[model samples]
Target: MSATTATARPTRNIESLTERAAALLGGTPDDETLRRYLNGLSGVDAVGLEARAADLGTRSIKTTSKVWALDKIVELIDLTTLEGADTPGKVRSLVAKALNPDASDQSCPRVAAVCVYGDMVPIAIEALGSAHGDPDDGGVSVAAVATAFPSGRASLAVKLADTADAVSNGADEIDMVIDRGAFLSGRYGVVFEQITQVKAACVRADGTSASLKVILETGELNTYDNIKRASWLAILAGGDFIKTSTGKVQPAATLPVTLLMLEVVRDWYRATGEKIGVKPAGGIRTSKDAIKHVVTVAETAGEEWLQPHLFRFGASSLLNDVLRQRQKISTGHYTGADYVTID
Candidate 1:
């Protein structure tokens, strides 16, 4: 726990403390009540509580980052449908689908990320470009799903090994699914630990660190407020990026989920001066939808967020439309969606 939190752990009960805080900040506050209120804010995992509280005091919010590569986005859309279940030919076919570099100039992605499951990291890392003489054109560096993906229910040792195995196979980033059962059960420490431990296991061959994006599967969280809280919790607990879903859940990513996360990113950065990333995976399948996300960041979070670091679409289906729109805008001719491929 952060010293701030350790010092602020409530010494008294809520009613008395909140009342006291009101009196101290005075609009007619009470005794120990004030202590409780301050304790509440200070008691959140020290990193999250006090730091976030400090951030809430800022004057204005900065926007998302602006500099990012579209090609990178096109490169990393994890086609999880083919993972583990596919043979080498099927995987190669999917890889072919992934590395296709047709989207160029105005018709390209905003830089795709490499999406492979634990078993496919080596293939994706080794075969992501045309430079290898593969028909595939470009893609982001590899990102492998870890932490017993699709569900974070597992022994910590197993989860850690999964993360290490992916990076050892060449994944540049680790996408870890958080333990929702723990989070929902109010076992915050376990949830925090699962992520931190997974992140710790994501080291490069040279001993550097791979970035971590924690998946909350927002649909199951059930409320914007809880989603926002979870975003804060993940970052405070050591997430490099806060993601919406695992795509395995129904009612996955949504505008509201993205909006709340953006707000938290805005808040977290302001508080800690650390820029956290955001990814909205699952069910976001249209270019217009992708652009709407862009619009939200451009407007709510600021244009600075246009880059791949601060923003990404965890999609297998959206790129086709983005390419179609880019093609339509660049060449002045609208094309059929199939020209780009859907899955």
Candidate 2:
């Protein structure tokens, strides 16, 4: 299937976040335009998408460029640990690593955030205290995977409760997984409504709300067509970021998948005049892979999306490799794994 284009075009016209939200939810705002745009979306050509992503992956970088990319990618990282064995101690350790990814080099930039399960949010918050300050004050954010993360096969009440628990515990961001089963069944309305409801659940008691990243789990979606649909679905549903996978699935966070997401965010920005982020979790483990992703963001999405606010890599191991590469650039030789903390 080939990708379809409809009324999705960018314009200089911009609207306030409130206006966009009202428009999306109805009443004072209307989503008729958004509905038309989504309805007009066309199929995606899987072969062409894979080919283009492969071609873009071949683009190369040198020493100086790699150095710059390493630092930039560091800031785009969402250093994550979502295992079943995760403990408060483990979350604290990961938080420490995120704050100082490379203790050996003070020049190394801190990661964008530390992602953990909902129960671990308080631990991460405490560990990161005063280290970078609150997220509004330049401190690293604490992200929690909620809404029955990695599966999303739960009731709405349960999901919202899970989200409320995380936000109440001081999570700066909430990475919620959509109900892919509903999405796959062509129940677009169900998927969209759930996202809006989850977005609402992100609000804390202080009138502040956590940033919401809607995970599409592109692996389960199967084709680029579904990925495209899901991408627009999440965005229209008020997702702050459209993520690729949960890392538990095979074929998680591939280059083609991420490249497509970058394109979606770019298109969404053009059509809505609002910027959203793209995060590819799971298999991204090397500095080379990380830089290629940044290159894709620059070429496909634009340089502005290269920042942490608009782009993030969801991996725990990727940070250590980035730090190790930075070490090699500094000392002229690859350092042992022992040189960096085990994240």
Candidate 3:
């Protein structure tokens, strides 16, 4: 099947956060306006959401289709390593893996991107060398985690600087954690401004902006309602993607949560004629789990989202399992534990 491209909307034309917020809220971009708009959103039906996700998971794919799904999952993965102990060698190794996930089978598709820390962006770029460009063009992208990733417990100045540093260092994408404290405390305007500012900081010297993925860390949000609200807030504030977690928290990237996020992306596209991406990061560690997500994306958001630009899996170990599955399908036998690399 050919990949479908979604219509691109230029967020840079909006000029300022205030204007962006005003365009969404229909009034001044103040706390009151943000609260009113967000609060007016419909509440989530937890039972219905879970039931739909579960039903989608039970749908089986044919063996021939499974081949396509496995390769597509590989193409959609943001091969990630965000450890504090990550070194230049580790980044280089990861870039190599991203470029060639299965050395034995050159037919294996490359992953979407290699996610790393802000400080490691240059290392990832240097490692990628000629193979780093656009994921849509079969080249791996360098995605950096910034804005006080995971905890997000820092001042706005610090977060903006973090974003700027990453983009300046040649990160093709920025995964930023939102201030959950502010969002939960009803400081919706604060979260909105932060995302918009971070988006601004993503602008590079060449006049192009790095893709900004706003991490909601839904485990901390506590309810499906907040997840839906946060997803909308991220889109309204110019986030290119709404990510589920920073991979440090428990209960990250549940199917129900991902389905809800996809619903939001679908809704946004329906209302605005622009497409937004979704990334379900953390705890997705197997081919079965990855294929389930692929199904959910297809059913809820339409097959157009099957493209790398619209959907992604933020994972590390998930690739090995997928490579194993691919080998099993090709040779009619499962490979040993050493078939895939540990990294």
TM-scores, all models, native as reference? 0.71, 0.86, 0.93
Model 2: residues >4 Å from true position, as ranges?
A: 1-39, 132-138, 333-343
Q: Give the alpha carbon lDDT tens digit for every residue of 124-227 in model 3.
A: 88777777777877878888999988899999999999999988878778899999999999999899889888998987665667888999999999999999
RMSD of each: 12.2, 8.1, 5.0
Compare the candidates by lDDT and give the number of the best one.
Answer: 3
- List ranges where model 3 is wrong by over 4 Å: 1-20, 334-343
User: Model 1: runs farther than 4 Å from truth?
Assistant: 1-84, 103-110, 129-139, 331-343
Q: Candidate 3: what lDDT?
A: 0.86
Greater TM-score among 1 and 2 belongs to 2
Q: Of the candidates numbered 1 and 3, which has the greater lDDT value?
A: 3
Ranking by lDDT: 3, 2, 1
Score candidate 1 by lDDT. 0.60
Which model scores highest in TM-score? Answer: 3
Per-model tally of clashing residue pairs: 38, 3, 0
lDDT tens digits by residue: candidate 2, 162-193: 99898887777889999989878777777877
